[model samples]
Target: MSRTPPARFTRPRIALLAAGALVAGAAGTAAAANPDTRENAAAAPGCTVDYKVQNQWDTGFTTAVTVTNTGDPAGSWQVEWSFAGNQKITQGWNTQISQSGTAVTAKNVSYNGSLGTGASASFGFNASYSGTNAIPTVFKLNGVTCTTGPGGPGGPTDPPDPTDPPAGARVDNPYQGAKVYVNPEWAAKARSEPGGSRIAGQPTGVWLDRIAAINGVNGGMGLRAHLDEALRQKSDGELVVQLVVYNLPGRDCAALASNGELGPTEIDRYKTAYIDPIAEILADEKYSGLRIVTTVEIDSLPNLVTNTGGRPTATPQCDTMKANGNYVKGVGYALNKLGDVPNVYNYVDAGHHGWIGWDDNFGPSADLFKQAATAEGATVNDVHGFITNTANYSALKEDHFKVTDTVAGKSVRESKWVDWNRYVDELSFAQAFRDKLVSVGFDSGIGMLIDTSRNGWGGTARPTQPGPTTNVDTYVNGGRYDRRIHVGNWCNQSGAGLGERPQTAPASGIDAYVWVKPPGESDGASKEIPNDEGKGFDRMCDPTYEGNPRNGFNMSGALPNAPLSGHWFSAQFQELMKNAYPPLP
Candidate 1:
């Protein structure tokens, strides 16, 4: 996506009357006092403010403020206040805060900008003061004055409905008991195709692959438009809107065909132009009720592990990303900003077992994930979970043989197809990797999403049972469900098929089996055709080009005559339907 100018911030002075005093204590210890709560009176066509001293010490204190719009809905909002004492803010979260003299402005970030009527947004800051930390007598929303008085609309006394999920709060499994939004645009295309109606109604991810995609690319639906559609489809029940947060500076650095518009060093542009805007839209109050699951930066972090640091498969691009640290920074920034929206769940893309299930790649990739998750002011908590096999054709389960299977005194790992990788399929890899991620400090409750979109391997070639124990190589190759030349041949693979339909909690540690990669989208052009999307031609996408070390020097195995990455490929779609694992009836 082309970079756009940074968004200009508007500062409007509004005021609310809030009064409080902080008790002094020892230099390092918190003061002994109950938390202080301050409220603002109702203002017609205005707002209310709830300011509280959450914690305090002898020289430092933290404060939380909630602003509720009692008037008409606002597309974006800002809350401003002043410090009566010498308290100076050290840092803040959940809002973009800036201080000037005694005045402070807490502006909404991308996600929290929308404030519907009676909707409340909260932010907090830590400050240091030599004297008493006095709550300012005034608070403001936009330019309106909030008077010091009793609680008004959406006030402390007016409790929220117990049955409703708290504004921005996350559920254990968003897909559970919720309807996933079916993209009308994709559905329309599917319905236009013969026999496409069978899976046309299924939910697939909306790829925000560029900055242009946020607003709408070439007059297509934008992020807000999709959310609005999701709301309309929600009825009274919960709904999940899947989003592929795929744009990063120098994205997909290990390969071509998916190179991003931003150069390797353009991390700042990535923040200001790409991630920030998307965060703003997701934070908008108009879409708060919808469960938004963001698949963050596919094909990124895994490259840092398997394709960098002088590895045989290493590319200069991957080396550049590792050296510049932009990949980690970009992913971290995306997680930190996007995670602030309570209802948005972030699932970082973990490459499939074929790429990183080897002993050398597995643990290191998890560590790298931790590094990215914690970078740029992000904590592990920012990540809701991890997704595997996104946009790749990795079989969800190799039911014919196990990784532990041995044939003629040889383990399955000895087979050329298995290549000593510890996993036989995406499901086993995802489940095992979840434990590894938790071992490295992620929350244990974290779930895994398996992209079963094109990994079905269910055409006439799909093996129904284990092959004869002739030899390890012959047995493994004959019975393996993934029909690609090699696991690493990851473009528009020939004979690839649709995998599992979208479902929830299909197995242990699995949150959902999702079609995160929409069927019918080409992985890349079959040849050198190119345009302005910053996508380049990769030989791996070519039908006959010899492979690199990444794909074991095998034939490309890609279908012939494809389009650029993300463009529709009609022949590939028809092939996917013809080979759909469960067989479209």
Candidate 2:
């Protein structure tokens, strides 16, 4: 059997700094609130606004406003209000604040943008006021005037407690009884190390772990071990076991740090030695009650498509892989054999939003997924969903960045990459990708899983919350945080934090958001070590190496002396906890 080189995987491009320097915009003028405008403030539309003065001084005052969406599920929103006096907002949080004359507009930040029906989100601002600090009467949501009287249509007479979940929304998963497995190994590792205690506050206890890498060279625990573990864990109420099937000939393409020991000529050995045994074990009748969800061959099929440009030079193994068609053969075999088991659910890894999030990319990516599904006797039904941002952190939301295309004369940031409207965050990308898959004949019910594990590193430059900005780079660099030296640098990146906790039914078009890559696992070693493992050092891991074309990043910001990919890195773990978004308790 001809073993082919494994396909390569790289991180998405980090924020590409604008060619021109950021031109700072004007700051709003200081003003005093006028008593006359206080009575004019009235809410309109299907929303209501409650503005309160949290603090007041002679020249400036602080206020917090709660905007409640009583109409529908608003994935994004804009709230507008005019000042009654000379009040001008100087700063704000949890919103994108903009001011013109006395008019003030606040747009939702990426994370806080989505408002379920009857759901309320709050933001606060500090403003300089002139003579009188009078509240403006006019308020609007998405341009419709808000009402100060009884709430508008579909709104509750009494404002629902802001802390309560939205009334008319199914904000959580419908499959209430289903629980995905959390690998005990990761938790054990965390507790044994420094900053491990932070793991207790995160979703680490609930995250699904991957059993990767059945390269022909490494010996793996037989199916018996997997089955026994799943059976034992099943008693704890987890109905499904999550396993990552990630051994391909020429694994990880020519990417040295992640190269699997399996060579391109090992297809026969791959099937007989790996997939066949794993499938036979999963199919056992005794383990029938355990639902096995296998993330089949990540970075494999996707690489065959992404690596066609002759860039990111593929290893000779990958060349044979393409020439011999071993990857497809292997994935087809795995999917088909695994699908044979009634208890198994297979989700082909689709890389992440950064990898295939572009318009030109998702369609082909979906087609590739479809191809994988149809390859064997395995039909689309044999595949359950697509996993994205697996083991990668491309932000859940990019709140501050906005772009206007010079040629198209439209906000390119708002185009396919951005959906032509809302800021293109991971959620938006996942939702769109899910729809594209459906259009291409995949089941509409096909759900998506996002690895929120390490993607949460908002860079040190990130604002505590969104505020006013006109310069694109300033807005992006200051308001949004992503610590990657470059987007393509995927190793143990610097400044990364834990992303959203594991959740089911996070939003429509998504089934479950998982932590497939457990937090604390190093993407790769910071520098070459004496370890004898086949994993080689990619210069991207060297803090001193400036950068390269394939991944224009030197990874100077990465954790130093980190272990090889998938091994423990204590410093990175500690940093992740320190920088976690929701702030580890």
Candidate number with greatest TM-score: 1
- Encode model 2's per-residue lDDT on 294-322: one tens digit a residue: 77876777676666546464445566676
Q: State in Å the error of residue 551, model 2.
A: 2.6
For residues 150-236, could you state the per-residue lDDT of candidate 1 as single tens digits?
344334565675544444457766765566788999988877788776667678999999989999998899999999998888876
In model 1, what are the clashing residue pairs, if there are any?
14-140, 15-139, 15-140, 16-138, 16-139, 110-280, 111-283
TM-score against native, each model:
0.72, 0.65
Segments in model 2 whose C-alpha atoms lie over 4 Å from true places: 1-176, 200-223, 236-238, 311-319, 402-423, 458-460, 465-471, 530-533, 553-556
The CA lDDT at 525 in model 1 is 91
Clashes of each: 7, 37
